[model samples]
Target: MDKAIIVFSRKGLFQKTLSAFDIRSREHARKLWPLVSFDESRQMVTWVSPSFENGRLRRRAHFRVLPTQTSYNPKQHFDNQENHRWNTVKESTEHRLAKELITAEISRRLNYGLGMPWRFKDKDVSNFPFLGNLLLGADRVVRLCCTKI
Candidate 1:
């Protein structure tokens, strides 16, 4: 099981065992999970959120990414390297969930009355770096590219 999924499930955000569709969806959440850090001691995972204070909105988080030891064994070193290379290559594949997260984040902020002027539009796309191509269908899809907020 993915470490992030386990942590999120512990937080009641997901089930311990994910279905096929859930597994696919959770994979996207995994990448973003690295942006935050989990506290095993407190059983809390913290990440940045947009907060409004003093008539302004800003990013805030309660915790930072924790460092972990990387174990190395001489016998498995070669195999580990090969596996890491393959995983790196696989990571280049398209990320649909990331785009969806950005759309949801946009909607959440909009609900809080932010980004009112920069509604999803070609002219305003430059301003919102988190957003990408907008796809409209029975289910509205907003393409997004991941970047540091």
Candidate 2:
């Protein structure tokens, strides 16, 4: 699944730093919504506390966006496109397990996978694939627009 940054304002549960709930339209930005907050000391972003209950945090993994052939692919050690990208593991393991970060509207809207760029090397890291692989208690749901499902 793709990675997404869910801003959690420290002021309160509903309060947030960023007004709009958005990031790049890429796979990472769409699938995985790791609720997080900005880290001033490290000058980077960090994950926040998730309300998920379980002992399976390690089982959760990052969705590999882009294709294996593309430089933006997280699986590869590419040195480009670091402008808006941030390593979730590098920052902190705060909000890795979210209770219900993704909203119903976004999930339904993303089912089509329309904006996903075709993959030239490997399969695109869209929500369908990501959700299909969602852990038993990962708490996520996604539909595929390309398929009849």
Candidate 3:
């Protein structure tokens, strides 16, 4: 199975509720309408296809996970209704659980494999000169074309 690393979003708590929906919706929209056009009236691009008579795209199905299936304990965490002090134990527990949930959901839906531990090193810095030469060549070509125009 392929290996991967899971990184939590900076948005913290809100990411839990929104991330799954966002991913599914984006994937569904991409599959349903490979190309989208902007509507001047709405001032935004939509998933509606020109081939469809109604110019409407089907809604994406929502994914739900029961609380019993995962270690997530929503009651232990703070919410807008409760003004409880921040607890590191609760935060860490929830964070870890969230990661597990997201990783499992992504794996199940997208057919991704389990995550593996890995490390990164800055060994590629030596290749900078080669990249710089390629960029310089492209810049020269662009300059030549601009001058000709």
Judged by lDDT, which candidate is best? 1
Give the alpha-carbon lDDT of every model: 0.41, 0.34, 0.32
TM-score of each: 0.17, 0.14, 0.17
lDDT of 1 by residue, 1-149 (tens): 11322334454533343222233333444543422222233222323333668977664323333445232233365578777777765534345566567778766655555543324545554654344333321233345454322
- Is 1 or 2 the stronger prediction by lDDT? 1
lDDT of 3 at 36: 15
How many residue pairs clash in each candidate at the backbone level?
0, 5, 0
Please state the error at residue 90 of candidate 3 in Å: 30
Better by TM-score, candidate 3 or 2: 3
Q: Please identify model 2 stretches exceeding 4 Å from their true place.
A: 1-16, 19-39, 52-79, 82-149
* Clashes, model 3: 0
Query: What's the CA error at residue 47 for candidate 2, in Å?
Result: 3.3
The lDDT, on a scale of 0 to 1, for candidate 3 is: 0.32
Worst 10 residues of 1 by lDDT: 34-43
